[model samples]
Target: MFGDIMGMMGKLKETQQKIEETKKRLDFVLIDEQSSDGLLKVTLTANRTVKSIEIDDSLLDDKEQLEDYLVLVINKAIQKASDVNEAELGAVAKDGMPNIPGMDLFK
Candidate 1:
């Protein structure tokens, strides 16, 4: 019984170490998400950095349309960033504790 407990403990510790290493690795990756329309683009790094943004040239031809599309694009980018963040966090949470309830894991 004691041996089994020790084995489990060691396993848990190793798993934790792996999780930490994965988090560090995530820092180097950029999880990009965007909309089907070229107006909305988001490039978010795993470290939570916003890298760059691009807007469509045609939208600039119309003032009101440009403003509307700009707002739409920003919102979409933010939503996409949130989704990527949540998914990554969920993966990490499941890797460690898959049984925890109310673990929105991202929230």
Candidate 2:
């Protein structure tokens, strides 16, 4: 019984290490999105943190329209980031929990 407990603890530590490594890899994953009209662009990490934005000069003169475009572009960027995160981290999670039936659905 004691050996079994020790073995499980060792597996738990290995799983924790894998999760941490996946998170670190996710930090380097970036998704870029642009508005349909090419007027705005945004870059974000897989965790949905905005990294940068690029706007066309033509939008500068119209503050209201620019704001709208920025919102649209940012939303697209965030969504893309979410998809990327799900695909990447989801695989890691599935690999870690291989014995759980239908575990892939968790993503």
Candidate 3:
């Protein structure tokens, strides 16, 4: 009984370590997004940190249009980053989880 608990605790600690490592790794995982017309582009990490933004000179002429493009493209990039972050962390968590009777946390 206690042995099982101790083993589970150890597994949980290892999982936490792996989660931290995965988060660090995600900083290098880049996600790119752009506008449909190709006037704006964004690059970000899976950790949701923006790395770069490229805008065509034509977009600089219109404030509202540029704002719209930025909002759309950045939002798309954030969503993609979020997906990657979740998947990576989820896989690590799921893989490290200890199987407990009737818990079924991953399901």
Q: What is the C-alpha local distance difference test score of each model?
A: 0.63, 0.80, 0.97
Worst ten in a row by lDDT for model 1? 98-107
Per-residue lDDT tens digits of candidate 2, residues 1-107? 68776776777677778878877887888888998888888988888888889989999999999999988889878888888887877677666653435545555
Better of 1 and 3 by TM-score: 3
* Model 1: residues with Cα > 4 Å off, grouped in runs: 56-107
- Supply the TM-score for candidate 3: 0.98
lDDT tens readout by residue for model 3, 8-104: 9999999999999999999999999999999999999999999999999999999999999999999999999999999999999999999999999
Clashes found in each candidate (C-alpha, N, C closer than 3 A): 0, 0, 0
Candidate 3 local Cα displacement, residue 13, angstroms: 0.2
Tens digits of lDDT, candidate 1, 1-107? 68776776776676677677766776677655554666656666665667776667775678997677656655665666567666665576566543335655544
The number of the candidate with the highest lDDT is 3
Model 3 CA lDDT for position 69: 94
CA displacement after TM-score superposition, residue 30 of candidate 2 (Å): 1.6
